[model samples]
Target chain A: TQLLEQSPQFLSIQEGENLTVYCNSSSVFSSLQWYRQEPGEGPVLLVTVVTGGEVKKLKRLTFQFGDARKDSSLHITAAQPGDTGLYLCALGGNEKLTFGTGTRLTIIP
Target chain B: DVKVTQSSRYLVKRTGEKVFLECVQDMDHENMFWYRQDPGLGLRLIYFSYDVKMKEKGDIPEGYSVSREKKERFSLILESASTNQTSMYLCASWGQNNYGYTFGSGTRLTVV
Candidate 1:
């Protein structure tokens, strides 16, 4: 229902570059999850943030939730080829019901 | 490691044929879900089962049905396959230990 909107539908950058993707919504969210899906595989949940203004880090990846809880951002530093995948943001409504328009990132070697 | 397994990696079937996609999870999770993914439109939930014989409709449940006879296995049945139904289907289960849904490799189905 267009609840979540992700920026940069497609992004390609050189290896070792830094990048950030955004997921925004006008409706407030109770909790949000970030997932990475490689080609030919189901998406894997990277992290979940429940509190407003919360931040979580996984290796070179950094995730932040907005203070209003209506948006989130994912930043990657010194990205590698292995960082290439589609990043999706999902809202935990009734039961993790909705997904954002994904950002497909490609880190070129 | 705990796993969610889908029966077929790929399938090609004639239009109007009945199709069955099977999924099983070994984690003994209490919840299981089915989702179909497409190119631009992300993953859309088709159905989910919370417990044995307890099923719930998701965002896009039209033209689809699910059966969970046991705690481990869940099935998605297409009463009559159509070209529109050709998409990558995925199965997932939620576990308290895992803290998130673990997905199957996915089944890419084609209708001719």
Candidate 2:
């Protein structure tokens, strides 16, 4: 089974601060997706990176797929209160997805 | 926008009862998936179907069964509800082009 591990399981930061979360795995993936979930709701996909060393930006959030396709990262620039939610990284291979433990982020005002 | 709808947002069931969770997607997606979300375990795939009447077991398929008789609908059946089955259940659907999946609001099941 392919396992994805996320760093800083819980993050608390002030508004306007920049924060980065890491997702690492030993096995390579064909593609990777990032999702943000609000409380009591299912996750919403933020971005998907299919190429190694690919970077995608969605407004204030940036996602990067590692060169080896075995890791990824999400960075939030000038986070706001609305950015407070659970961030999850999922690795895809053979049409199946392996999700990370998730990072619960809180952007305090 | 693609829409995924779950039958219930919250459900309470007793142990040994037969439970059924229904999910529907309006996007005409070819792939549908069922997963359970726990506090620390993240999302564990229970079952997925690529086409009508075609099913495959996911990472955690024990104690759960799924039926996909139509392209737009999928159902999850719990033969005998147990306390360990109490968790948030999520349904998702995606197309064959490897696009991002659209998820439902999820159903929170509580077994006593």
Candidate 3:
């Protein structure tokens, strides 16, 4: 089975600070997606990257797909309290998508 | 926009009782998926259906079964609910070629 390992399982940061979370895997995927979820809710898709070395920006968040298609990263610039949530990365292949362990982020006000 | 709707936000059931979780999608997506989310395990796929009357077992499908008799609705059934089945259940759907999934609000099932 293919697995995606995420770094810094938990992150605590102050507002306005910049933070980055990484997702790495040994298996290559056709596409990758990033999602942010709040308590009691399902994850909301933040962005989807299909090309290797592609970068997509959504407001204050930047998502980058690694050149090898086996890794990805999410960076938050000037984080805010609203950004505190569970961040997850998912890989899609063969009509199935697998999710990463996830990174729980807390932005202290 | 794609909308995936789950039947329940929270449910409590006794052990050995039969439980059913319902999910519906409005986008007419060809693929629908059911997953259970745990604290540290992230989201583990329980079952998925590619088309009407078609279902496939995912990574973890030991105690779960799914029914997708129609394109827009999918149901997850627990033959006999157990304490270990308590978790947040999520439903998602997308087109055949698209990998981006639109998820429902999720159902938190507690088996006591």
Candidate 4:
């Protein structure tokens, strides 16, 4: 079974601070996706990175795929109270998508 | 816009009772998935269907079953609901594109 592990399971930072979350796995993935989920609701897709060393920026959030395709990272700049939520990394291939243990972010105002 | 609809928003059932969670997609997606989300476990795949009447067990499928009678609909069944089975059930669908998945609002189930 393939497993993805995320670091710093819980994060609490003040508004306007910056933070980064990492997702690591031993198995290489063909593509990786990032999602943000609010409480009591389903997750919404933020971005998808396919190539190694590829980086995609969505407004204040930047997502990068590892050079080996075995890891990924999500970096948020100038975080605000609205950024408080759970971040998830998913690897997709062969008609199946495996999700990593999420990173919960709390932004203090 | 693509839409994946889950039948229930919140459900409470007694232990040992049978439960059914229904999901439908308006985009006529060929692939549908069922996942359960816990506090630290993230979203664990329970079952997925690629076509009508065809199903595959996901990472965690011991106590769960699924049925896809039509192309746009997928149903997840819990033979016997238990306390451990209580979680937020999510439904997702994907088309030919590999961009991302479309998820439903989610159904929160509580087993008493």
Q: Report, for every candidate in turn, its global Cα lDDT versus the true structure.
A: 0.91, 0.93, 0.93, 0.92
Model 4 C-alpha lDDT versus the unseen true structure: 0.92
**DockQ (Cα-based) for each candidate:** 0.63, 0.70, 0.75, 0.76
Clash-forming residue pairs, model 3: none
How far in Å is the alpha carbon of B32 misplaced in model 2? 0.4
- Give model 3's TM-score versus the native structure: 0.97
* Per-residue alpha-carbon lDDT of candidate 1 for residues B1-112, written as tens digits (9 for 90 to 100): 8899999999999999999999999999989999999988888999998899999998989889999999999999999999999999999998656556788999999999
- Residues A51-108, candidate 3, lDDT per residue (tens digit)? 9999999999999999999999999999999999999999876467889989999999
Write down the DockQ of candidate 4: 0.76
Q: Give a tens-digit lDDT track for model 3, residues B2-71.
A: 6899999999999999999999999989898999999899999999998999999999999999999899
What does candidate 1's lDDT look like per residue over A20-42, in tens digits? 99999879988888999999888
| Each candidate: chain B TM-score | 0.98, 0.97, 0.96, 0.97
Which residue pairs show collisions in model 4? Answer: none
- Residues A3-65 of candidate 4 have per-residue lDDT tens digits of 899988999999999999999987988899999999988899999889999999999999999
Q: What is the TM-score of chain B in candidate 3?
A: 0.96
Per-prediction backbone clash count: 0, 0, 0, 0
After superposing candidate 3, which stretches have Cα over 4 Å from the reference? B97-99
lDDT of 4 by residue, B1-112 (tens): 7799999999999999999999999997889999999887889999998889999999899999999999999999999999999899999998886478889999999999
Candidate scoring better on lDDT of 3 and 4: 3
